[model samples]
Target: MSTLANETYEARVVAASEPGVTFSGALSSEWIKFRTLRSSWAVLLAAVVALVAIAGLIGYVTGSKWDGQLDPEDRVASAPLQGLFLAQLLIGVLGVLFVSGEYTTGMIRSTLAAVPRRLPVLWAKGVVYGLVTLSTLIPTTFLAYGVAQLFLSHFGHSTSLSAPTAFRAVLATGIYLALVGLLGSALGWIVRSTPGGISLLVGLLLIVPVLLEVVPGQWAKDISHYLPSAAGASFYSSLQADGALSPGAGLLVLVIWVAVATTVAAFLLKRRDG
Candidate 1:
């Protein structure tokens, strides 16, 4: 072959052999890492089991007491989704560990080396974790809802998926949990330590809401609705309370929180050494 032709053929071959890095590649890597972690699977299983079990148990108890103890408003508000109170903690902890675990094991150095652009790693982790949470939680929510309603039906208090606001509430539960998971992942990136990430997550989602109630003012009431847990809960709440955001608004608020948290984490990841 002519020298020029040989050079051109070699260039083409090299280009074909290396497709280069992409968001999809990073996402795939993150997904593989996520699935390989036994702790991740355990946490996910625990969340699903807790959601379904607690929801069914609540339904049974509500049904047993429906004759005289349960009031109309209570019946309307007592969704099997109350199990989300437990699911959120489990899912959030998983999110924290998703990134923090890498740091703890000193594996982040290899991860960063694989993706020198850096930000894609954070984006990939967030997207993969969010999708996993959404996919798993949505089906689990439906299962819990179905099983719980079976028991509640005995007391004539069961609500169908076709009932007003029923489907939206169930759908929102998944979205809420997905956002919660992303929020925890973002916090993990920022804190880069499992204990710190978990502590901040628990404080932000659980403790702050309770402490806000003790402030005693319309101002505190106004602020309370904007907190992460409060806003997320508004999504699946069948009945809107006085201080809560509407479903659409609550979803928007949680999305904003996730966006802001991830953006900050991205900035830090890029600026700081791995």
Candidate 2:
């Protein structure tokens, strides 16, 4: 072929390949990486099992002695979703590993090379992980609720899904967990160290809340409601606890936290060398 013909062919090829690193491509890449990780599957399975087991235990124990031992208020508020406390920790750790594992292994350099624009990688990771968490956990939450209610029904204490806020509460539990997973992913990207990311996540969700309790009176009450875990808890609570934000407000607060973390991660990702 002549030089002009060869050049024309090369230009067409380059143009065709230029779109390879697009947002959709990045999302697909991230999804593959996420699903291939053995640790990811293990953590997800563990979260589901723990959620179901804990809820079942609560149901069984409550139902066994419902007539005389259970309080009326407790029966009414019995969501058996305490398992989520454990699920959060497991899923959060999975999120930390999602990014930090790649960093620790030096895989991030290649990842950035493929998606030089940088921010798409962050967005892809956040969206993929969040969707995975939400899809898996939402159904699990419903199953757990069903199993728990089955046991509780023996004692005439089961609440219906049609009960006020019941369906919303179940749905919100999944949303809260998905947000938590994304928050953890952002922390992982920012810290780039497994231990560091996990520590920060734990402190934000658990330790900080405890530390705030040391503050006296209204100050603690005023501040604690905005913490990530507290805000998330409000979503699934049939009745908002005193000093806690309402469900809508709580969801907004948690979204802000996720957004802030993502923004910081994206900034650092662009500014720092991979």
Candidate 3:
């Protein structure tokens, strides 16, 4: 046999031996694969930039409109959450792209080949994606908040992260981004089509829900609160709503969604032909 064939044979033998391999080892290999890819870093950086720019622009425009009637407190409370509506979209897209892009580029095949047990691969991807997104989101959000505060401070509407609501918003922003990323990755794994996964995510986040809201009924408003984006949005509210859930309830909604998606994805990954 040729030398290349001999090497391939040897590698296959070593992989087949696999007696000493552990979950941690598998996860580490997956992490290496994830971080070594250039697209991962690029997309993450782009998300941060997009979120910051959009938030800052909104701040600047609103600061310009601050006729000084709505006291600093009111202005700060009202405007800071504006950017999040768009920021979540960017984060959600990035999250979906993380998994779906692999399938689009035919990288999923190589990824699965390296780790023949597919579930571990998915789990590792979730861990890495979750941590990376959380890290980026926390800092990006605080930075956005600081930038917004700078604009607000100019108009005597400054806010600090130390405040109870501001602190919760900062933490919730990171947590919300992480959950969205997890949900996107799960859906991407199941759908395995970039456009399809993204469309599903966008539909859940913006499209189907918006149409439901426009129907002009109280039931729609009540049901809308249970949707992923709407439930997640509750965490950012400076003042808790009268009938709406507490922050913990909002987080529980996010958790349930992520759990359901991941479970379904896991089932599909194990049973379906890759």
Candidate 4:
């Protein structure tokens, strides 16, 4: 063939090799879609406001106490989780909606059509939710702590973030939110319906504890510690002080839950159709 013909052939091959975009680029596209959603912003703002309000109340009450025996460290450590239960619920729902909303609105078909490999879509949403959860949790936690400390100071019972346990508790709480969001995303993937997934999540968080309490064995309490919400909430040192679970133990349990949830979600995604 002539040199011109060879050059034309090479150009054609290059265009075919490029196809469209890389997997990472595809993932970025999903992230952009997720960030633009109104629910994402609303849930995140709710988490922050709730955290500050609840923690401020806890700190304010402790500051006004007449017992004169309350431990400031314990109060400070526990302050981060004051609104965690409520915040986690919102975060979980947001994570679920991130994926299930797509399914409900028939957007997942478009997503899958663009990226036939289904797992990447899940992975991208997981990454985006984790980032968004972490971003919201960090600032919300610190602001909550700051507000709490402000009220506590007026009563001469104050705390500082410079303390070792204070810092650890803050870090753990924020990380736990991200992990919980990811777990919710996984459950959302497995369930694929908004109401069903939310119901399952609420069951996991609330009903399990009630069931455990009704049972009649020490094993029940011990095993309940392994549940995601149970263990995750242990990040709140106030609750941990109640001997529910140690901080390290809580972290381990949460990691196991996330691992199991993610694995199951991946399997279901591959097996299920869009």
TM-score of each candidate structure, all chains considered together: 0.92, 0.92, 0.85, 0.88
As a TM-score, model 3 comes out at 0.85
lDDT of 2 at 190: 95
Model 2 lowest lDDT segment of ten? 9-18
Question: For residues 131-213, what per-residue lDDT tens digits would candidate 3 score against the true structure?
Answer: 88888888887887788778767867576777667888867877787788888898898899988888898889889778977
Q: Encode model 1's per-residue lDDT on 19-107: one tens digit a residue.
A: 77799999999999999989999999999999889878988888888887765555654377788888898999999999999999999
Candidate 1 — worst ten consecutive residues by lDDT sum? 6-15
Regions of model 2 farther than 4 Å from truth: 1-13, 17-19, 71-73
| Model 1 ranges off by over 4 Å | 1-16, 71-73
Model 3 segments more than 4 A misplaced: 1-20, 68-78
lDDT by candidate, in order shown: 0.88, 0.88, 0.77, 0.80
Give residue 135's error in model 4 in angstroms.
Answer: 1.5
- Give the winner by lDDT: 2 or 3: 2
Candidate 2: C-alpha lDDT:
0.88
lDDT for each residue of candidate 2 in 51-120, tens digit (9 for 90 to 100): 8888788887888888767665456543677789999999998998999999999999999988899899
Q: How close is each model in CA RMSD to the real structure?
A: 3.9, 3.1, 3.6, 4.4
